[model samples]
Each structure stands twice: as C-alpha cells, then as structure tokens.
Target chain A: MQPKRLSVLGVGLLGGSLGLAVKSVASDCRVIGYGHRRATLDAALALGAIDEGYDDPAAAVRDADLVVLCTPVSLLGEMLDRIAPFLADRAVVTDVGSTKASIVRLSEERHPGIRFVGSHPMAGSEKRGVQFAQSDLFRNAVCITTPTDATDREALEAVEGFWRGLGMRLKRCSPAEHDRLICDVSHLPHAIAAALVTMQEDAALDLVGKGFLDATRIAGGDGGLWRDIFLDNRQNLAAAIGRLRTSLDDLERLLTPESSEALRDWLDRAAERRQAALKP
Target chain B: MQPKRLSVLGVGLLGGSLGLAVKSVASDCRVIGYGHRRATLDAALALGAIDEGYDDPAAAVRDADLVVLCTPVSLLGEMLDRIAPFLADRAVVTDVGSTKASIVRLSEERHPGIRFVGSHPMAGSEKRGVQFAQSDLFRNAVCITTPTDATDREALEAVEGFWRGLGMRLKRCSPAEHDRLICDVSHLPHAIAAALVTMQEDAALDLVGKGFLDATRIAGGDGGLWRDIFLDNRQNLAAAIGRLRTSLDDLERLLTPESSEALRDWLDRAAERRQAALKP
Candidate 1:
C-alpha cells in the first residue's frame, strides 16, 4: 500500500535520501521534509528529494500516513515528543537511528499513544548533508526492523513494507539484538577507527599509506553524529571493545614468542574469513 | 650514474614493480628477476617488468652492479647470504621489506662485505603477485631509506638516486626509527584489521556496512607477508598496540560518564586530523 503522505524529520543524508527514494519508487506518495535549517530543507526540495519543506515537524506529520525520524540518536525522544500530539491515529512511525535499543525504549516511554516501529537501514557514506543524498542510497541495503512484543503488528508491517519498496532487504530482530549485532558490525568499527587515528603522531601523517587511510576512513565522519551513537549505545560498544581488546591481546601473544606457525594460521583464518564476508 | 644491470630477488609485486619502474625511467638498465617459481619470473618478463629471469640467485647477481632483495622479511637474511658470494665488489644491495631494523641488523651481520642499504616503499595493495605489478606503483609514493653509521655512503647515494628516478619522494632515518614509525602507520593498522575481522561472528557478516569493509580491508591481504612484518617488528608493533589500547581506554572512559563535551572534543579532533592528513 502506498503511503498517502510520508514525512521525514532532519532531512540530511539519510532523510533526504529516503525522500528521494520514496519519490522514485512510489509515485503516489507525497514526501514532506522537516528540518531545523531552512537552507537544508530548501536544498532537499530543490533537488526533488521532497515535494514540500517544513520548518515545523508537527505540521509536517499532521496528515502523514508514515513518518520516519532521521535525526541523531540523542534527539530521538525529543523529536518524537514534539510530533506525538500531531501524529494521526493511523500513522505508523519509524526511525533510521543507528542504535535501536535506546531509541525504541525512548519512543515507547515518551510517545506511548503513537505506534512507533524501529528501523535501521545499513546504508550511509562518509559524506553528509542533503547535497550528498541520492535516490538509490537504500538499494540492496540491509534494513533492520526491531520490533518487540509490545510493537503494533500493523505498524511493523507498514514500516518494513515501506523500506522494501525502496529495494531494501529486511532483517527482523529485537531492538536489543539489533544493538548487540550492530555494536560489532557498525559501532565497534567507528570506535576503532577513531582510536586508531588518535594514536598517530602529527609528524608521521605524511608517512602513512593506503592501509592506514582505509583502516581509519570512518574517523573522518561527522563528530556530533558519531558522538551521539557512541554515547547512546555505550554498553554494547564497550563490550565490543572488550572483545577487540582480547583479540588484539591474542595477536600480541602470538607475536611475542615468535610463534610463526600459529601466527600464520591466525592470519590465514582472518584473511579467509574477511574474503568470504566482504565478497560483493 | 645508471647501472647497466639491476637484479631483483623473489620478483613479485614489489620486485616486479621495481623492475618495471627502473626499465621505464632508465632505458639502458637491464632488469634480471630471480624467483623460486619459474611461472612468476616468466610472467614478470612477459609483462616487461624484467628483461631476463634467473632461477639461481647466484647467477642473477653475478654480473649485476645493483641487487635488490624483494623477498619476505623472514627470508631477507637467507636471500642475502645466497647472493653474497656472487655479488660484484662495487654492487649496492637493498630491499623493499616492510620492517627495517631486523632486516638491517641481519644484513649487517651476514653480509658485511656487501654494501647493503634498507629501503621500504610505502606503496602496495591488498592485491599481490607479479600479475598485479604496475610500473607506476612507486610514482609519488613515499620510500623511506634506513641508513646506519656503518652504511656505505656510496651505496646510500645510489639507492636514494634509484628510488628518486622511479619518482619516489624519499625520507632518511635510522633502521630503529624506521621500524618505530612504520609500526604506528603500517604494521599496527594490519594487526588492528586482522583483530577486527577475528572478532566478528560468521552470522553477523551479512549486516556489515562499508565502514566495516573499509576498516578491515587489509585483513584480506596475503597472510604470509603480513605475518612476517608483524613478527619481524614485534617490539615496535607492541608499543603501537599499547598506544592504541590507551586511546581506546580513553574513549571508553569518556563514554562511561556520558561526557558529551569530552567525547565530542575527541571525535572532532580525530575527524579534523584525518580530514587534513587525507587531503591529496
């Protein structure tokens, strides 16, 4: 079923891309963008990512059948609270927040009257802003829908269906599981990249090769955005870091004794696993 | 002065590329490739990376005025010993090994009669073998030369001049300093990538994004090669790992108290440094 009106909050890369994707895939759906900055909303409208722009999120969602919150994780509860009273009774709300457990918990606590299903589309770039948004950002991307026993079945179906229309393959799991899984796959990598870059000396920057650049490429991402992610999912991220520390410690141990056979075996296994996992 | 004959032992990606670059820049130079595998040497010759192929290391360096050992770090000492008996009196020997201190020490101990200078060109890809060798691999790349007090000045000049002719920008340092710097920039990244991959669950691979892929891309590299580098420079790599641990610990501490300002400051600094350093 095509949404009568689809509203997106904070139309940056994820939100603007969602708008573009909705317009391209479901012609009948009217996309409305709500953002804090008029210039960003205007850019989204000018690029045809949204049919209309709104400075007021409440006004944008008044008639929307589906509303996707694409703001930073820290502001999810605040944004939901702002739009809760204006949301239609039949409206199905979802989010593209990086951390699922915190956002889902906040939505359930703050806007219990509204049906909020959580989603996290595993698609993004190091680049940011509405100017970098594309129509096919979610194509072939994995979108995780986190639904608990308390979630409305109809809202979950609508949210997953909307993402599927944009060519996303859906994975259904609990918000806690999503947080745990994403900690290893997404949040952990960002933290590692940041930590890796922080260890480098300013003078040695010129000596770096493509290996260092590729390994730490995500460290160049927006600070405020990642800071929110790191804080919102601190427990899972910390646990993941502990696992990484153990892995690294094992590697160091293998090196200390010059255990050539064991070290080569470890490297071989890692290479094989990465090759299989990273295949396009 | 251009050398009439330049021999490369264990001709693979680094060695074959060196051969190709030398041929392109010094038209009069004849490149002789020696390798354990005849097919590899034949491929190098067919690709014009080398003018001739030799199965015997002794025969390969017998008439050459310059010999470069392009073997793995673990085998550098053995390869030098194999060619020492046949090395021309005025020949300058060097290598493209990633770690310098161990190889330099081994060279100085094993082949004191031969003029051996250690060089590492900070250029490579996850892809390997002679088939992937490109003549311009070292063009605009940073090649560090490790020359100690015992290093022959004439050999040093010839090595520096050769890398310069191949369009490489040079940095001069001691073998220990080279190992220390590379541990932070090269070897440490490799270990981190491997550890990151090792921490992943097989089932979670489907959920990985570009961030995970880019961050662990080097984990898919040749196991033997990286294993050699990690083992050869264990002391410096261990030190770098300690620094990375401290950085990660600092991040975890910032996360524990919900220290938004501190976390943001750390992320902003990392992002700024990466952005500035990564600019072409």
Candidate 2:
C-alpha cells in the first residue's frame, strides 16, 4: 500500500530525512512538509527533502494517506490535536518521537478515528535541522515501532513496511518496553555525558584528549531536544541514573588495596561486554 | 643536544612510541627498549620501535644520555631504583608516567644526583602494547612537563627541548598541579565510563547506538593499567569522583518541570564549552 500523499510535520533532521528517503525510493509519492517557521519549510524544499511545503498543520494533512509527525515529544500531543479534524478518513498516521509510551497514549486519546503508530528511528547526529538531512540517514539504521494490542494490524504492517522500504531494519515492541529500553541505552547516556562535562574542572580543559572528546561529544547535543527527552521519560531515566550512581559508589568503595582484584574484575567485565557488542 | 643513545623502559605503547618517534627524527640516535617480557621487547625491535632490546633495566640504561621510563605508575619507583646504579654520570632521566607527583618525589628521594624530570604526554588510545605504537603518536600532542624547584635546570630544558623536537606542544606545570588536573580530566572520566557500562542492564544492550558507544568507549581500556592509576592518585581521583557525584545529583534533582530551566542552562553551558574546544 504505497502512500499517494505522505505529509511530514516539523521537517527537521528526522522528518526531512524521511521525506528525502521517500522521494528517492517512491517517485510517485508526493512528500509534503509542514514546519512552524516558513524558512525551515523553504529550506527543506530547497534541499529536495520534500516535494512541497505547508505552513498550516491542518492544511498539510488534508489529502494525505500517511502523516508523520516528526516534532519533539513535548509538541506531539498538541500537533495531533491540531491535525485531528483535518486528517483524511482512514489516514494512517505515525510519529518519530523519542519516547513511545506517552506519544502512543496521546495519539489514542486525542485522535480517536485516525490510525496512529509510534516509531523511533535510532539514527541521527548531534547536529539538528533540515540542512543535515540526507536520503541515506535511515540506511542500515534500526527503526523500532511501538505497536500495542489495540493498534490496527493493517496500520502496523503499513508502518513497518514503510520503514523497511526506506532501508531501515524494523523491530516491533510494546510502547512501554520501548520507553524502558531507550531510557537505559539513550536517555541515561545523554544525561551522563552532560553531567560529566558540567563536573569537569575549568583548569583541566586544556589537557583533555580524544578520550574526553569522544566521551562528552553527546553533551554537545541541542539542550531543548534533550531536555524534552529527559522530561518525557523522567521516571525510567531517573531509575537508570540511580543504577549508574550505585555502580560508581561500588567502584569508589573498591578503591582499596584489598579490593584491587575486585576492581580489576569489574573493569575486565566491562571491557569484555563492550568488545562483545562490537561483534556481529 | 640530540641524545646519542636513548633508553626506554617498559617498551609498551608510550616507550615503544617514544623510541619510534626518536628513530624517525634522529637517524644517528640508537634507541634501546627494555621490557618485562622478552616477546614485547622483540616485537618492539622488529616493529622498528626500538633498535635494540634489553631484559635488565640496569643494562638498558647503561651508556644512555636519555632514559624514558614508560612503565605503569606502580613500577616507576622500582625501575628508577634498579637503573640508578647503572645510569651514566650525566644521564638525563625522565618518565612517561600518568601521575607526576609520586614519580617526581620518588626520583628526588630514591635516586639523588640522578637528573630525573616527570612528563605526562597527553596522547594515547584505549589500545595498548608495542604493536599499536607509531612514530607520529606524539605529533602535535601536548607533553606536560612537571618540573619542580629541585629539578636540574639543564635537565628540565633538555627534557622540554626533546619533547618539542618530537613535535609535542610543551606545557610546564608543578607535579602536584598535574596530578590534580589529570584527576579531573582523565581518571574521573575513565571511572564514569566504566561505571556506566558496569551499571548497564543486559537486556537493554541490544538497543544501544553511537551515543552510548562514544560515552563508554574509554571503559574498554586496559584494566591493570587503569587500576594502578586509580590507586596511585586515589585522593585527587576521589575528589574528582565526588565532584561528578554532585553534578549528577544536581541534574537528577532538576528532572522536575519546575527545574527545566535549570537543566537547560546546565546542558547549554556544557554544549558551549565542548563546542569551544573543537576550535583550534
């Protein structure tokens, strides 16, 4: 079921990339982009990220079969409400929000008639905006779809097939499970990076090398985007942070002559696990 | 003056790299490497990291104008003691140890009349050993010379000039200050990275991407080497870890809606600082 009219709201990195990818693969599909700022929409148009641009959310989804709301988590609920009355009858809608559980709940409660599926493409750089978007951004990347029991099977399949067609590896999981997993792997790492940088001594900045640079690279991410992620998945991320604190405390306690072997074992295991992850 | 013979003890990454770097620049200088393992010494020699290999520290230091001890922090004192008896009357001794205060103090107290200065080269990978050593490892890297009032003026200039000749940018600081700054920049980051991986839930590992990978890459560093570092500079490192804890606690406390502005500001400052560092 190829979407004749695919509308993408908030054409930033993720949305613009999706539009460009769709344009590359589905030549017949018309990709329309909607952005709060007309300059952004024009930028997406100039980059060939979208075939057309729309300033109004309702106008964007008017004749579209598939609508991808690609705004931050905080803006998703309101965007859904704004486009609800204008979404075509039986139109299949989805989102590229970081947190899935809240987005899924909002979609189900706010837009009763529209078929909405939650998606999170695990690809992006620290940089944002439509200018950074490219057709290959989703190539070889994992696109996790959060589909609940209440979701329409056909709609879920369409979303999965769409992402697969755009060169993404698909993983299906419940929205709750998706949130929990991303909290540990994604959200918590961001918070840790930020905390690491904030804790650095001003005098030591000149002595830092590649190790420090790599470790803190993600801390240079956009603050507004990360703050939304932190707030949306606050509980799970907080729990993950607690786990990290415990790990640090345990290591701190092991910093003794008698606990040398214990500390070595802990570090050895971490090295092994990280090495194993690099393997196929 | 260009050293006629350069002796390097513990010919692993740093030692082997120094030998290679010296050989690259000064073809007439003979580079001798000493190691605990015959295999490592032989490997260093075969890789052109050293012109000759020695098993005995005393034999290695004999007739050398410059001797760079590149062993772990725990072994530097013992290596200095072993080679003290055989050191040339005017031999300039220096160490490539991570912690400087202890090494400088050990040299002053344990081997009087031997001209020893402490240096910490701000270069290296998470990887180790002679096989990974390269001639250009120290190129454009900052080589911190921890020279105290007791350091012989001629020896200090020789050490500084030697590092500068190898293409390293030189910064001179007191040994105590070097330890304090490195604790914040290097050791604490390694601890945080290790703890992040150690605290990870196994079930969530499958979903990790570049953000987590970059944040924890240093956790894969050699365990024994890092253990020595953590123990040698326990006090300063402990203080750094405490600072990190306070930062994490502050971020955690700001997870609420009312503190969103505070969290954003924290992240913004971190981002700005990191961005500023990428510029030359």
| Candidate 1 per-residue lDDT over residues A1-280, each given as its tens digit | 4797999998999999999988898888899989999999899999999998999999889889999999988898899989988998899999999998987888778777789999999998878999999999999888999998889998899888889988988899899989888989888999888888888897577688888899989888999999989888898989999999999989988995448889999999989988887764
**lDDT tens readout by residue for model 2, B1-280:** 5899999998888888899899899999999889989999889989998888989999899899999989988899999989999999999999888899988998888776899989888888788888999899999888899988889999999999999999988888999999999888788888988887777767667777777888889988899988988888888988888888899889889899899998888888889888775653
lDDT score, residue B157, model 1? 93
lDDT of 1: 0.89
| lDDT by residue for model 1 (B6-91), tens | 99998888888888888888888999999998999889989999898989999899889989999988899899888888888889
- Minimal lDDT window, size 10, model 2 chain A: A271-280
Clashing pairs in 2: none
- Against the true structure, what is model 2's DockQ? 0.74
Worst 10 residues of 2 chain B by lDDT: B271-280
RMSD of each: 2.1, 2.1
How would you encode candidate 2's per-residue C-alpha lDDT over A1-280 as one tens digit per residue?
A: 5788999999999899999899899989999989989999999999998888989999899899999999988999999999988888879999988899998987788665779989998888888999999899988777899998778989999998999898888888899999988898788888888887787666688778778889899989899888888988999988888888888889889898888988888888888887765542
In angstroms, the error of model 2 at A190 is 1.3
